[model samples]
Target: MPYKLSATLSAHSADVRALSSPTNDLILSASRDSTAISWQRATDQPGFVPSNVLRPSSRYVNSITYIPPSADAPKGFVVTGSQDTIVNVFALDKAKDEPDFSLIGHTENVCALNATPNGTIVSGSWDKTAKVWKDFKLAHDLKGHQQSVWAVLAVDEDKVLTGSADKTIKLWQQHKAVHTYNGHQDAVRGLALITDIGFASCSNDSEIRVWTFGGDLVYTLSGHTSFVYSLSVLPNGDIVSGGEDRSVRIWRDGECTQTIVHPAISVWAVSTMPNGDVVSGCSDGIVRVFSTSEDRWASEADLKEYEDKVAGQALQAQQVGDIKKSDLPGPEALQIPGKKPGDVKMVKNGSIVEAHQWDSASGSWQKIGEVVDAVGQDRKQLYQGKEYDYVFDVDIQDGVPALKLPYNITENPYSAAQTFLQNNDLPLTYVDEVVRFIEKNTAGVNIGTGGNEYVDPFTGASRYQASTASTGTAPASAYMDPFTGASRYISGSGSTPSQAPSSAHMDPFTGASRYSGAASVPAPTTNILPVTQCNTFKQANVAAMQSKLHQFNEGLQNEISTSSLAMYPQEVTAIDEIFAYLGQTIATPPQQPSVTLTAAHVEAIIQVLSRWPTSQRFPVIDLSRILTGLCPRVLDAPGLKDRFFEALFKASDWSDPWSPPPPKPRETNILLLLRTLVNSFQERAGLEDGAWPTRVFESLSQAPYAVLTKTQRVALATVLFKFVFSTKPRAPRPF
Candidate 1:
C-alpha cells in the first residue's frame, strides 16, 4: 500500500522548514515564523495537535532535533537551530517563550541539526563549519569545509558526518576530518543514515547518492526534478525525501516507489516516525503526516478536499519541464494504463492542460493539477545543474563569447553581480552596470515580500523594498532594514543624524545598517571636534575570502584574454602569506604570523586591482583594506601611498558621476575604499606629506553630498573625523 494523508497540522503562519519525528506520538517542527512547535498525537483522534510552541529565535528556526530526557528536563529537550546563528534547547515539560539553553558558536545561520542517543548534538551552519555540543557546552568545532555546511548527521557519540554546499561529504572523528566523499555535482542539501550500507545524500543536482563509509559509491537515485532539501529513513528501510519539486517521494532499493505530490511550491523537510509514517514540512506552512495504514488515514471528506487542493493548483509549464501544448495528447491519454506508480502524463482537455499521475494503490490516474502559462513563465531555468530565476547572456567585450549571469530573484543583486564578475574574471567596476542590467530586466516584478522575503540576518543588505503596484520604482522612504524593521537612513532634508530613528544608524566600516547599541556621538559643534575615535572594519572570514580569490584566479588562468590578469607566482605567494598572516591575527588568542608582510604583498594587491576588471577587483581591494589597517608601514615608501589611493579610486570608479542609490557592488567598493581611507589616518600612515590625502579628499569631493548613500556618507564623515584626529597636532591654528 502507498502512503496516504493521515493528518494535517497547520498553525505556523509561514513556511515550515524542518521536522523531527522522534516517535509515533511526538513530532517537532521548526518554521520560518521563528517558532518551534511540539505536536502530540491525540488520544481520542488520529490527528496531532500543537502541544507546545517554543520561540527559539526572532529569525527563522531552520533545523530541529530531539534529545532524550534527563534529570534536568524530565520530558526531554527539543533542540532547534535558527538563522540567528544560535542553537536553542527547549524542555517539553517547561515549554515557554524562552529556551532552556542557548548554544552560540557558529558565525552564520545554523541550517542543519542532528542528535545522538547519548544526548550529544551536532549542528551545521552557513559559516562553513559544523559544531558538536554535549551537556549544554561546546564540545568540538568541526571546521574544514570550503563552503556552507548544509547537512549534518550525528552517527554516534564519536563519529559525525557533514554534507556541504562545496559538494563534498565529510566523515569526522571529533574535530578532525577523517575522509571526504565527493560525487555530488551541486550543493549537497540533505543526508540520512542507512541501516547498514553507509548513508544517502541528496543535492541540488536533483540526484540522490548512496555511499559507504569505506569511501565506495553504492548507487544513485534520480527522480526529483529540483533541489532535494531533506531526507529521512523509514523503519522498513525505505528512504523518503522532499524537495523544491513539491513532492515527497518514497524510494526502495534505488527506485522511486511512490511520489506524494504537495499543494505547495516546496516540501522543505521530511522525517519518518517509529511506526513508519512519514512527516513533511512544507512551504505552505503545513506539517503533514502520511501513513500506509488505511485505518490511520484521514476521513474520506478530508482526503477529497486535500486531493481537490492539489488538483486545483495552477502549475507553470516549467515546473513539469519543457512542455509543448501542441505535442500533448487529449483526454484519451488517460485511457491507457501507466507502467509505474509515480508516472506523470500531461493531457490537453479542450483549452485546459491537466497533469495526471498514476497511483498504484488505487490503480488509476489521479489528476494532480492544471498546467498554465503565467507571466515570467520562463523564470526557472537551469544553469550549471542548478535552477535559477534568470540566466542572462552578458557580453563583456566585442568578439568574445558572452558570459552567463545566473541569478535568483530572491538573491541580492550585488551578490549576483560580484559572483558573475568573479566567475568571469571581469573587473569590479562593471558591478554597477550588471546591477542596472538586472534591475532593468527584472523591473515591475514584485520581490522581497511574503514567503520569498530575504530573512537572513547576515545579508540584510540584499533585502528588497516592497514596491507599490502603481509605480515600478521601490520607494526610497519605505526602505526598511531587514534586521531591525526600521526605515534605513535616507539622506535628505528633515533627516539629520540626531533626528534619525534610533535604530537607523549605519555602520560605516562594514556598510551594515543594523543597530549595534553604540551610544550616538553628539554632532560636531564649531570644529571643537566630536572627541570620538573611529573604528575600522577588521573582522573577516579570511579562509573564505582566500578561497574566493583563488577561485577567481583559477577562472582567469583558464581563460585566454584574462590570462595576463591572473596572479603571478610570487603574487600568489604574497597573497597567500597575507591571508596566512590575517588568519593567525584573527584567530582566538591571536598568534604571530610566520612571515611578516612586506612591500611585495602591497604591490601584489595594487597589481591585481590595477589590472583586473572592476567586478573582479573587490577581493583585492578588501585585501588592501586589511593591509592598510594592520600594516600601514608597507605603504610608507615614497609614491607608494599615492599609487595605492590612485588604484583604489580607479577600481571603485570614483571619478564617475555620482548617482543617487549607487549599484550594490559599486556601493560596496566605495564603502570599502572609504574604510581603507579611514584606516589610513592612523599613526605612521605616510600622511605627513599630505599630497595623497589631498588627492583622496579631492576624488571623494566629486560626488555631491546629496548623491551619497547613507552608509557612504557615514564612511566619508568618518574619514574626515579620523583625519582631523590623526593630524590635529600638525594642523596650523587659525590666526
Candidate 2:
C-alpha cells in the first residue's frame, strides 16, 4: 500500500519526541516544548484539529502513551514522561491543562513510556532501570540493564521487552529477567511487537532485527543509513520504521518494499493509526499523517506543489556535471611512446544551467533549455562604466526600495553609495548621512576627517581645529568643535600666551628646558621609543623540576618492569592476606564491635585494592559487599558513619610514594559512593536528624556543577530525594 500525506499538524516549537492514539480518531503528541497536545479528527472535516494541550512537566516531555479506560479513570487517559524523571497520567476528560496524577520513582530522565493492556504503565529512564506502575503507585523495578534504558515495550501480560544503551534487549517476566538478547553493536533505540512469539528491534547501528520469544534471531532488516529511532507494525503485518536518515521504510518478508522520504532530518516517532494511517513525528516539530488508501487526502494544489518540488530536485541533480569515464584513474604504468591511447583523453568540467518552467498543462515542472559554461570560457558584462565577469538580476518590489549595488566587484563603497543615492532619487540632504551609513556598514571606506585640523575634501578648506593645539597665529573664531558643530575660544598655547618658534621644543624626558636661542640637542628627538617584542624565557627552576619528575617516573616504571616476578608474587600475597583477614572477620562475630575505624584499617583496604588485578572489578565489588555487611551492625553507632567516610577519603594511595600510580578521583567513583550511601540510608530508615543529607546538599551547592558528570549529578539528586525529601505515606488532609 502507498501512503499519501493526509494532514500536517505544526504547533510545536521543538522536536516532537513521541506520538500515540488514545482512540481511533484522537492523536496525542509529546514534544520538547514541555507539552502533550491532543489532536482530533473532526467529523466531516478534511484534517485533524488540535483539541487540547496538556503541560504537566516543566521540562522536555520525551514520551507519551495512551491509556484505555480503567476503574480509576472512567475515561481513557494519556501518560507523558519528561526530563523531570516523572510520569504523569492525564485524564481524557479533564481540563486541558494538567495531569490528574503523577508517578515518580525513576531518578533520571524518563525517556520512554508504554502502557500494558492491564492498566499497567512501564517507564524507561536514563537511570538504567524500568519502572512498572499500577494505579499511580510503583509496582516493580526492572533493574538489570548496565546502561540507560532507551525503549520499552509491553508485549503481553507475561512479557516486557526493554532496550538499553548497552546494546542489549532484555525480556522481563514479572519484573524479573527472562532472557537477555544481544546482537546490535550500538544502542538499541526502538522496539515493536510482531506477535506474542516474535518482535522487531532497531538500533543506532542502523539495522532492524527480528527476534523470537525464545531468544532466537529471525532476520536482520537493513535499509536505513543512520540511527533507527522508531518502529511500528502495520495492519498487514508489515513493519514501518523511521530514522535519522529522513526516510521511512516499509519492511515485509525481510525486505523494504516501500520508502517514504520526509523533509525533516530525523523522523523521531511513528505510530500506525487504527484506520491504517501512519502518523510520524519529526525533529522539524511537525506531526504528519500519511494514509495508505490515498483518495488524495491533500488538496490538488498541495499535491501539485509537492510533485513540482520533487521534479525540481531531480532536474537540479541532473544538471550537475557527472564524473565521466575519462576522469577515472589512469593506467598502472607510464604510457609507451606513440601508444594507441594517445595523450589520455580528458574531459573539461563544466556547470550546466537548466531553465525550468511550470507546465500548467501537465501540472508539473518541465525543463525548457540548458546552458553549459565550459571551463576557461569566461563570461563578462559591462555595467555603468565598469566590466564585471558576472551580472546578477536584482528584483525590486512595487514599493520597496531596490538594493543598488556595484556590478563590478572592485568598486569603492563610498562611490557606490553615491551612485545608489543618485539612482534612487534620494535628496542631497542625505549625502552626509549616506556617507556615514556606508562607512559604518562597509569595509575599506577611507572617507572621514583627517584630524582636528579638518579639511574638506571637496572644497580643500580647513573647517575645524583643536582649541588646545592652537600654536599657529589663527584667531579664536577660526577654530570650530566638530562634535558640537560650534566655534570655541582659543586657549593658551603650551602655557605661554606669546607663541614660540615652530621648531622650538623642550626635552621633557631629560628635565631640560628649551634654550632661548639654540635648538635642543637633536631637536628634541621626535622618536620616543620603538615597541619591541619581549623575549619571554622559560622558568629554569620549574623546567628542571618537571624534567626531574619525568626522570623519576621513568625510573620507577623501569624498576617495576624489571622486578615483575617479585612484584607479582608480593601483590598476590598481599591481596590474599587482606582477603583472608576480611573473610575471617565476616565469618566470626565479635562482641561489642568497635564503631571507630582508624587510618590503619583504611590503609590495609587501600593496599589490597591497589595490588589487586587491574582487569577484574572484584575490588570494587568486594568493597560494596563489605560496606553492605558492615552497615547493619553500626546502625546504633552515633557519628560512626562520618568517621567511616573520613577514613575512606584518607585511604587514597596518592600520598604513598610506593603505591603503584593512583588513578585520579573520578565522578564515577563519587556516584558509586552516593549509590551505596543511598541504599544504605534507605535500609536504615534514613539518617537520624537528617543532617547528612543537608550537609551533602550544601557541599553540592558549593561544588562547581561543570565538574560533575551527568550521572553524578543525577545520583546526587537521587540521594536527596530518597533521604531528605522522602517521607512515610500520609493520608490526604481535608481542605
Candidate 3:
C-alpha cells in the first residue's frame, strides 16, 4: 500500500493532547507529560525525528500553535499553553529546549491557543477569558464567557470565534463579541473554519454544528457518540472529527461518510495534511495517518493490528462478562414476584440481561445477553443501578415490605402492635416491650381505624389488620425504636409506671425525642452503637445503590459508542419515535379534529424541538396557524399552551453547542410566529399576561442581533418591541 506507518514519533511519557502542522513535512505535538516536542522528517533517515523538547515547567502542555515571523520575533515562534496557567513562546529555531518568553496572566490553566493572521496570538483559558497578545504584550482581554473557554479559532484578520464550557460560541471582532451562538448542551471543545462565511464547532455534547458568520445555525451533524475533542476541515471540504469515543469520523453533506476507530479510549486531536492524509493524536500516545485516496490504503500489517486489537477487546469483554455473570441473581436466588424461569429480565443493576430459571424460581441465569452488555461496556463495575431502580429494589428501613394490614380504629393498641410485630421481622423476644410501648403511646388514641389503615410508604401497600395482643396486660417498659436505635417507653404506663409527663411529645416516625422540659431526652447511649453500625451499613448500601443507578442510566444513554452512521443510536431511536408520534398527532386536515396539543404531546414536542431542523424529517405544522388557530383555543388547558411556547423557545435557542443557531428559514419562521403571538395578545388586551410574551422576550433578549445584518435584526427587534408594549397591563376603561 502507498500509505503505511512511516514513523512512530515517540518521546512523551503520557497521552498526546494536541497536534499542529507547521509545514507539510513538520509537525508539533503537546502532551499531558508536561512537554511539547517538535517533529520533522529526516531526508537522510527513513523516519521522522523529534528534538528540542520544550519542557517549560512541570505542567501539562494542553495546546500549541505556530506564530508567523514578525517584527517581534523574526524567526517566528512556537506558542504553547500549559496547566501552569502560562502561555510560553519559543523561538522556531531554538538552540535549546526552553521557552523564549512566558506570558503569564490567566489564573487557571490555558487550554486553547491560536495565532491570528495579524501576528497576534490568542489564548483561551480556564479563567473564562481569552487574551490577545501583540508585540509580546496583552492587547485585549476578551471577557464574556460564563465558563472556561475551551476553544478559540481565528477566522481572519479581524474576526475570531471562542467556544466555551457554557455551551456557547461567541464571535469576536477586535476583542468585542459581535454575536454569540448557542447550540451545544455541553462544553464546546473544538472549532474549525469551514469558509469565510461559515464555521464548525464540536462539543462534549457529542455532536457537530455548522454555522453562518452571522451566527445562524445551518445544520447539526450528529454521529459521534462521545465528546468531540478535535476537528479539521479536509482539503476536499469534508470535516473530520475525533473524540473520546476513539474514532475519527469523516462527514460529508451532514452525514458521517467514514469512521476510523482507534484502539484507545480517546482520539484527542485530528488534523489534515495538504496531501489529503488525516493524522490523529490518540490517547495511546501514537500518531496515525489515514489516507482517503484510492491509490493508498492501510497496509496489511496495519489492518492485522486492528483485527488483533478488536479480537483482544472482544476477549477482554468476554472475560469481564463472565465476572459480571457471577454478580447476577442465580437460579438459587429468588425471582421477582410472578416472574418465572426463562423470562428475560434486566439484572446486574439493569445492565446485564439475564433470564429467570424454572428450576431455581428464585433468581435468573446470566446467559447470552451478557455478551451484549460486555460489548457495550469496557469495565464490568464501571456503572451501577439508577436511583429509582434502587429505590424500587429494596424495602424501607424497618426491614418490613410494604404490606396491607386489617385493623379497627377501636381495636386494642396492644393487639394491633402484636399483629405488626408478628408480620414483620422483629424478634419474638421484644414482643412484650413493643406491646407496652404501643399501649401507652396510643393511650386515648386509636392508630387503626376506618381512616387509619397503615400504609407502607415505600411499597404503597396498605396494612388492614391489627396485631393480636399476647396478653391482656402490659408487659415491659421499653422497646427499641427501629429508626433511631433508642429505647422508647410508654410514658407513665410502662413496667416502671409513673404519672405521665405532659412536657414530652413522641414522634412515631423518627423516634426522635421531643421534650418541652428543661432537660431533653438524653441522646442514645453508647450501648446502642452495634445497632447503629448495622443500620449504617444497610443505609450506605442503599445510598450506593441509588448513586450507582443514576450513573449507569446516564452512562447508558451517553452518545459514545461504536457506530458510523449515528452517534447515539438510542437517542436517534427516541427522536424518531417522538417525530412519529407527533406526525400522527399533528398531521390532520387543518382544524378538522379538535387539534389540541396535550401534556404528552407537549412533552414530545419538547424532546423533538430542542434539536429541531436536525433529524426533523417530518413536515411541521405552519407556526402561524398553530399560534392563531390552535394556541388561543387551548390557552385554558393547564400548562398546555405555555408548554407549547416553552417548547418553541427551546427550539429557537441557538445556544446548543452541537449545531449552530437555526438558519434564516427556521429563524424567519420563529420570528413570524412571535409577531403573530404578540399581535394576538394585543388584540385580547390583558387576557393572557406573560404567557406568550415571556418566551418571545427571552428569545429576543439573547438573540445574536449583532451577528445578523442590520435589516434582519431591526425587523426582529421591531416585532419584539411591539409585542412587549402592546401586552403591558392597561388601565381599566373609565365607566
> What is the C-alpha lDDT profile of model 3 across 593-686, one tens digit per residue?
3333334443544454444343221122132223333334434466666666655545544344323344655554454444444444544422
lDDT of each: 0.77, 0.57, 0.55
All candidates in order of lDDT, best leading: 1, 2, 3
What is the TM-score of each predicted model, taking all chains together?
0.64, 0.49, 0.46
Query: Which candidate has the highest lDDT of all?
Result: 1
- Tens-digit lDDT track of model 1 for 89-125: 8889965887889998988789999999779999999
Q: Candidate 2, residues 1-735: lDDT per residue as tens digits?
A: 456677888888667889986455889999877888989887877778888888978877889998887777666888999878889998877666657888978877788899987778899987778888876798777876656788999877657899988789988887667678999988888999996549999987889999998989999998686679889987778898998665677777887766565655468899987677888997667798888666737887865654454334221112233434435333222222212210111222244344333322233333323322222102223242122322322212222212334332233434654565555324444444333332222211121233323221111122222232332222333222211223333432332123333233333335344334322111112334432221111111222222322222222222323222122344434434434444444453623332343333444444534433332222342343344334333333566555544333333221233231224343334445555555554444335557765654564465455555555455455655555333455453331
Q: After superposition, how far is residue 459 of candidate 1 from its true place, in Å?
A: 8.6
- Provide the lDDT at 603 for model 2: 42
**Could you give me the TM-score of model 3 versus the true structure?**
0.46
Q: Model 1 — TM-score against the truth?
A: 0.64
RMSD of 3: 24.9
